[model samples]
Target: MIIARLRSIGKWIVQKQLAEVVVGLFVIVASLFIFPGADLGNLGLQMVGFLVLVVIRLYPGFSVVLPLFASGLWYTGMADHTLLSGVLAYIAIEFAVARGCIIIAVILAIEWLVFGYVVSRDFNPQVEDLPGVLFEFLCFGGAFIIGQLR
Candidate 1:
């Protein structure tokens, strides 16, 4: 019975597209790596939330919702990569669902606004922040391209 269950789980993973799972994991890892000084407590919370989305995404037809929900969660949470993950999630959804560029554009706009206006409020406003901003921009551009190709 255990073997049977495992087989089914394996099948589910294949059907769900392993690329998505890997992308999700990459996002989580990237977030943690980029923000080494982030509060461990908050990072833990975001990791859990992202894991939840990854698990939910394994179900057929559920991929469509996972990205949007993950994005929403990140946007509302204190995670260091909230904006990055949110943008990545939306782009991933575009790749998974083939949603039009317009939707992607809107999501990008919202992310830019939030990252620019809301999320920026947390920073200390120092010249040292320049690196983080540049890192985020690079991540965003790289993620969007990767998502499109994935």
Candidate 2:
């Protein structure tokens, strides 16, 4: 029964053009650069999201929501005068770890904001289920990453 279901799912994915998975990989790479400090393992969640979207035929929404959420998170909790001005402040260092730190901080905030806005706007308010599901997913994922990294 499971094999039959898998076959059905495979057929569905092919019909929906799952061939675009490479583009998803490119987005992941770009996001890592733009949102530094998101290690590969963190990005793996994004990749899974992208693939699931492909399988379910909702890739666009996944793309829009993830980065926006991460960006929002960055701006809300991480960005600061210390982060923004660190580049100049750390001028003496051959490598500006402070600047890199601040930049990553900014990315995380921005990502969260984008996520909150997308879910709040796109997910139906009347039906709380979808939003609840996403919240749980984010919480679990975030906690797992923090715990695992520690």
Candidate 3:
């Protein structure tokens, strides 16, 4: 059953569910494109976003910059006709950046599983369970900078 598979995956997934994650990213990115006003191109943005976050995780210095770049890209694609749409675009980008951090974690976890299966390495680690609320920090901190309107 799909439910059984999900539980097994979750036991090892550590972060977000792999299937939900892929679907979530698709929904979010598709929304960005299909919502019309944003005009974001349809192709590789989601995968690129995932990789960008992975690189940022490994290199903390890029954490903010990568999100900022993604936000700028989505923002640039905006074709909204009013101030409300402008504000929404900014907030939406924030959501994208925040949610994006989690998606990258999902991809890494999946890759870890595949590589471990192939190489006979046990990739089990409680690194995920040991986590604090750093994502909250990333989201709020990113939001605050935008609040300053710079």
Reference-based TM-score of each model: 0.41, 0.28, 0.32
- Which candidate comes out best when scored by TM-score? 1
Cα lDDT tens digits for candidate 1, 77-112: 644444235544443443433223435433443444
Q: In lDDT terms, which candidate is top?
A: 1
lDDT of 2 by residue, 1-150 (tens): 999999899876544544334445556566666677764444544544354334323333333344443333334543211111111111101111122333333333334333444433443334445674466456534533432332
lDDT computed for candidate 2:
0.39
Separate clash counts for every candidate = 0, 26, 0
lDDT of 2 at 70: 33
lDDT of 2 at 71: 36
Inter-residue clash pairs, candidate 3:
none
Off by over 4 Å in 3: 1-8, 15-24, 32-34, 41-52, 71-150
